[model samples]
Target: MKTNEEKKALVKQQYSELALSADELKGKCCCGTKPMSPAKKVFTIMSEDYSKLKGYEADADLGVGCGLPTEYAGIKEGDTVIDLGSGAGNDCFIARAETGESGRIIGIDFSPQMIERARKNATKRGYTNVVFIEGDIEEMPVPDNTADVVVSNCVLNLLPEKDKIFNEIYRVLKHGGHFCISDVVLNGMFPKEFTDNASMYAGCIASAIQKEDYLSEIKKANFEDIKIERTKTVVIPDDVLKEHLDEETIEKYKKGNVGIYSITVTGKRP
Candidate 1:
């Protein structure tokens, strides 16, 4: 078994490769055979409604979110929004449209490649209201109490320091500012072996925290009026599993032991 440090390092390596590879970017496993197209399809379906917003189409092809944060953020004209883990800026593009030319949107992500992709997409779409920055979500470089709305999509579970992320989110948002995030959540504890699996963790499956624990952490960070606005089960297709996992692992994943789950969680900093 790999040490925790080793596991983290391996997962990081896997995702670093994923960021640049078109196949991996399309949600395929690193092995280059098994299709994760179903996962990508699900994300696309959920975010289809946001395509109507300006600048959204340029970023949509790069999106890997399970739900739309803009819908729940209640964004309006003149609002300043911050998107953590902005990925390819799908949410940023949508938020920019909602805020219009008079408003602004700042998108931050740790991955330099993703930041580059987002910036290129923004330029291609002539989005003057949106800016992409390279930074970690746990220690955001933005000014304190500056954002009217903060959003993240299917990205929080990748963090090892989740408490710090929530704290940073609270610190950056204005009083009464809202946090709307869509992320994967675990219904129950994952076995140690599974939790420690590098491929699984990098795939956004193994790192999920239980629903109650997720809420408790946000509350501890002092976010109030917390609520789960939506939940959806992401079914991993049988064919994909056969291509990716051995028989033993396939059985483990089938019995509700492992699957993608999505939840839209909303809270306010007060």
Candidate 2:
């Protein structure tokens, strides 16, 4: 078995290769290597429609994120905002518009390529206040209680020890600080076929735990006023399921309540 740190390294490597280009990232589906298109819609499973949102930068979106956490982040001018899995600075740029002149935005990502790309994007747009940091989420290189808001997008579910992440989130935010995050969650562990599949784990489904359990971890870390800001079911098609299960097993799973859902939640540390 791989160590938790090893697993995280794998996740970072997968994303680094995919980060080579937006077109390459768009072609990726969780465990499967299929191009995302309107007809396929697997990216649709975990990504939100960003066309309607303002302050969009083409390179930053990268087709990442399950929900628009920045839209609900309640970022004020001059606020300090930290994005957990900044990924090309999609949310950071949006948060930048909200934070305005005196505000500062920091995006943390373990992938060196992602951090470089985000920094380049900031320069291309001449944004001096936005900074991208290369570091792991469980152990962020940030000061205590410095951020007014923390945000992430479809990234936390991949981590093994989520409670550590919550603690880190709590540690980085100032008192009365809040977080808006989007990620996938399980209704229950899906078939062993999926959980056992390496691709599935890297894709965002296999690593997911029950939604309630995820939230309970947040509460355990001493967050309050935790609430789901948005939620939607992730529809994995029959074809996708078939890639990992037999017809009999697939039918059996259908009869059960196994589901993957994407949710954006906001919580406060009081």
Candidate 3:
């Protein structure tokens, strides 16, 4: 079994590769080795459509998000927003549209390649207020009470220690400030074999914890007015499950009450 640090390192390396290949695989989901046949959109189940949105930059969209956090973020013009795991500045750009020129947007990601790509995208759009910083979300470099709002999309589940990340999020936001996050959470635990795979961790599967535990962490952090904004069921097809599990494990999964869900949640930092 990989230690906490080892799991973090593995996630960083895989996401770095994803950022390096972002341009080539612009609209492709990073779930499987090969794209599932069109009949089965299993791998693409987590991603949402962003083409119609204003301030939508195709170059910045990596097609890895499970939900649209910005949609429920309640951002206002001239608010300072911080985006964790910004990934080529997808959510940052969308937040920019809402924040307008007076607002500031800071994107933090551990992947160097993702930071570089995000910075380039900001420059291309001539947005001086949008900035990308390379840093671990668990131990962000930003100051206390620095953000008016915090937003993240499909990134937190990749880490082994979610409590620390939530505490950090709380520390960074002002008293009335809130956060909106879209992330993957499981109804129950997967098999040990499935959870132990490093690639599955990066693909936002193995690293996910149960929904109840996930919500508990938020409450433990002293956040108030917590609410689940939206949820979408994600069904990984049988063919994709076969890649990781044997026939018996697959059958158990099918018969069990296990489910994967993309949930958008919000909470205020009191």
lDDT string for model 1 (161-222, tens) is 67989999999999989999998888755446556655566666667788788888899999
> Which ten contiguous residues of candidate 3 have the minimum total lDDT?
35-44
Write down the lDDT that model 2 would get: 0.83
lDDT by residue (tens digit), candidate 3, 1-270 = 789999989888888977786555543445746644432232244789988887899999877899989999999999999999998998999999999999999999999999999999999889999999999999999999999999999999999999999999999999999999999999976767777755567788778999999999999999999999999998876666776567877777777778889999999997
Of candidate 1, the 10-residue stretch with the lowest lDDT total is 39-48
Candidate 2 residues 159-201, lDDT tens each? 8999999999999999999999999998855667557656556
Ranking by TM-score: 3, 2, 1
Local distance difference test, candidate 3: 0.87
Clashing pairs in 1: none
Cα-based TM-score, every candidate: 0.84, 0.90, 0.92
lDDT for 97 in candidate 1 is 77
What does the lDDT read for residue 132 in candidate 3?
Answer: 93
